[model samples]
Target: MTDVQTDTTLCDPQDMAGRLHTALSDLVRDCKARMLRPRPGHQPTADLSGFRLGITWLAQQRQMDSMLDLAEQLVREAPALVGGHGRKPETLDQLRACMVPVLRALPEVNRPPAQRLEWLFGTLLVDELQCLPHAEVMAVLERNAFQPRHWQYIVPYLEQNLPKVKGTGLSWQGQERRRRLLGYAWQACQKAGWADRAEALFRRELSVCACYGELAELLVHRGDVEEAQTVLLKGIAKYNASRPELTMGWLDRLESLNGVG
Candidate 1:
């Protein structure tokens, strides 16, 4: 998102509404379960929390058809509770169910960006894209969303799926964060006197994988190709012991740079 877009998304009400829907649904479900005391006639005094939550859920709850039956039961039995004032609970919102199934849909690439992002926010609660098809997850990531929250889901996602997602991290707080992270990674390498001390420091601090082929570049610039190569190899070996793909990517970059590929 550009500056204007980012600023605009920060205050979007529909986004807030969806989030509110989830919160109120959870509250209503909890209250319903809480008042399940024995003897239907025995009603506790009306609690403000319960009333507010019930009102909100009735007004805004969406999705999650699974709770519809429960909602029906609550409504049917509402008259039994004297303190509740002879009211029936409304239908549970099916659109509000942030269940595991909806997260599997990757509509971003094929649909409007806003809609895709909306779907992603709901899916954020789903288990890893492991349950999603690889092709579908790839498609979702390829498209962009105005939602920074999507990035919250994206980082761990890339880390979990590709292992290439590790980075020194974006220090930039407001939007364009990924770019700032890249900049810091490069700057650290440049200031380390070709020791790759910066990249190493970055990986240690940020848990981001050091950039591929960066170590030797640092050493080569310092006029010590051999020592640099050794540092690069050994560093990569150690990294490989823990993060083999990272090590492999660096090794491949090294070979490619040397025209061995």
Candidate 2:
């Protein structure tokens, strides 16, 4: 992860619009179809709950050391989860059973020196606009975005050594295409500013299969207590529980937002 300089706004509106336009154009070329119309708003309340549970369950599944092969097996059988939600587990026991391998392996796969993001993310950038799982990925990204203090466990990797496997930058056309496409998205994001992304976070349609208590809690920790409170209230109202996990996540988010402490 790059060191976040400051909480500077990213992707100014004018910049983001242009980037969005360019991304949409590349998307057309890649998909070779009429572009899908985009309607903004977060995920539905119900889906957010489902996604929240799904990820929680996913986190619980553990695999480690000698138990490691199970990580590969889990992805092979339940590939849908690599991206987003699906049918809930039949029972608490089943849920735990499903997640154990992943839980054990996460120490190994989580982003960093042992970064196995490649396996989970596959060929797609979790941050990419075209990916269906983007909303969930965005939550993960936001949780870590410009907030590096929490990642003390994962050893850092040099950005230079990290793979840029997206396009072999050899050919002129390939280089140009990559430039026009990614440059536009990044420039747009930087220009549009972080506020646009923050607004995107609050939308229910995009926040589906998500958790708000934690998100709200982060705002509170940041002294944006009102936003934090709102996120938590909405989450509890929707889910009908004041879970410790959510509580802890909120606190952690706040702590991280505040800095390494």
**Number of the top-ranking candidate, with lDDT as the measure:** 1
For candidate 2, lDDT tens digit of each residue in 1-261?
011111224423333333323432342243222123323443211122222233333343321321223323323323232222222332223323434434434444445522333333331222122222333323333432322332221211211111342432444344333323332233223333433333333242213333364345334534676565556556555544544554465455545544332
lDDT (10s digit) by residue, model 1, range 157-261: 332333233221332221123323333334323432333444444344333434434545655666766755666676686677776855686677566556321
Clashes per candidate, residues 3 or more apart or on different chains? 11, 38
TM-score of candidate 2 against the unseen true structure:
0.26
How accurate locally, in lDDT, is each candidate? Answer: 0.38, 0.34
Deviation of model 1 at 110, angstroms: 14
The window of 10 residues in a row where model 1 has the poorest summed lDDT is: 91-100
- Misplaced by over 4 Å in model 1 are 1-112, 121-126, 141-246, 259-261
